[model samples]
Target chain A: MTDDIQSRLDSIAPLIVDGSPHAVALGLSLKALTPGRAVMGARYDESLIGDPDTGTLHGGVVTALLDHACGMAAFAGFGAKDTPATLDLRIDYLRPAKPGLDVTAEASCLKSHGLVAFVRATAHDGDPDDPVAIAQAAFMITKASKLAQERARRAYTEGRME
Target chain B: MSQVLIETLMSAPYVARFGVRLERKGNELTGVLPFADHLVGNPLIPALHGGAVGAFLEIVASASLLASQPLQRLPKPIDVAIDYLRPARAQDVYARAVVARSGRRVANVRVEAWQNRIDAPVATLHGHFLITPGQDDTAAD
Candidate 1:
């Protein structure tokens, strides 16, 4: 956490993601964090296996892992008070992750424009060169409901222009 | 789809963690995710974790595929594209998968997850899965 970035992030509140229950449930841990980047880790657990024949980690586990990591990056990038919400996410799976190996995901905010922040992430069990899956996502920088309410209130005050 | 396979999917380790239930009413099948405290992402808003909900939909998609074919191995997710239409409130969620097409090697599925109303979905997932269909020799053992 750099001073310039920390100063900006200070107002963001105790990161909306730290120690989240699903992350806790998945045993996801924050390995590293910077201004607009984050790395998370999750150890392979048999209980999370999706393919019994292959003993491969479930795709859902990878989805949650990558999603959280992406959110972390977006939150860190936005450095705002409100929580970031996923507007949409797209993941491309390259191959099945090796069983019994710990998985690590690295995510970074690609760009932030207006109310949306774009992020990308990759999950790899060992080598970064070969990723298990790749994720690209956009997250709303502010709580969506607040934005909707604000728009509605403005509409109410200004009268329905449309 | 075989009843035994359906039971197997519902009992799978990963799917079981979310307490996902699969039920069939005549020709229809549904997936349910019972609400639990651990599934909450933002305690401030108390919203359900997007990842949790996303994962639930993936399982539902997989289960739906399994119900239609006698695949030799569990289908592996190739990719998923999800759109969060609304914030998932804290409550039991229901999801159903519609198989757009099932090809020789791949299957396309569309999944919708909703809480209160079926038409108003919190999120929807579209994905392709690699299906390896064959006999389950292990079942004999």
Candidate 2:
């Protein structure tokens, strides 16, 4: 089952990459993939600075990145086709993230019962032991037909194989 | 228009950069944050970033408390819980907040954001603020 999940995740890499703009804008790229789990990282950029005195990255940007990562993890767990909308997300900020530091998020799907997927993610600047923020999120899977058609159209327009 | 709420938010250095505007109708308070193309979630999708909506909610929640007590000073948010119901479309976002309860030490406020349609809220926020009483009373009215 783990191997199968990994294979399914590999196939959707391009789609995940294309779906996240905040990741792209901040230079956050996929680092690893597996079924129900994904790792994404962003090289710190001065452009993403929120506070100058503390060199803290804006909380909004971090939340966006975590949301996209959690969504991807939920999508991967679905195995076939699904569009997940965030139902709720709660984040706890442990400490301010300094600018010019690379950050990575490890997102894992805790469970998927019926149409709802539960996920948890932790983001760290460098040391995994000390996380900057931790989040728990739930995503609701919608019908796949319309979203599948949209993805097909997008893939074709963007010259990517579906 | 409550001059106190408007002046208070505009005076804040960080809030000023976001270009937040306050609207008042009797006792109700509405805050608007204009859409900037750069803040879009996905350039291709062109939806308002969820994080931006969260920040706007915090500001609106704080401002709403100030508007409710025009004679008192504003409160500082100790914590805020935001639930994103739907993606905010690429358009100007409008937020309205109600002060649920205000006490000497703590205040609870609820804020909701929408575009043109109020029936469907894109996001909702419940914030708890720490009040600093008698701070705004120093101003000469």
* CA lDDT of every candidate: 0.81, 0.70
TM-score of 1: 0.87
- Candidate 1 lDDT, A71-117, residue by residue in tens: 88887777533347899989998998998999999999998767789
In candidate 2, position B42 carries an lDDT of: 42
The C-alpha RMSD of each candidate to the native structure, in angstroms, is: 6.9, 4.6
Tens digit of per-residue lDDT, candidate 2, span B44-87: 44466665677778778777776666534445455556787777
What candidate 1 gets wrong by more than 4 Å, as runs, is A7-18, A144-162, B135-141
Number of the predicted model whose DockQ against the real structure is largest: 1
Per-residue alpha-carbon lDDT of candidate 1 for residues B6-110, written as tens digits (9 for 90 to 100): 666667788788798888775577999999988877655567888898899998998898877677667778999999888898899999999999988999999
**Top candidate (TM-score):** 1
Per-candidate TM-score, chain A: 0.80, 0.86
Q: Pick the candidate with the highest lDDT.
A: 1
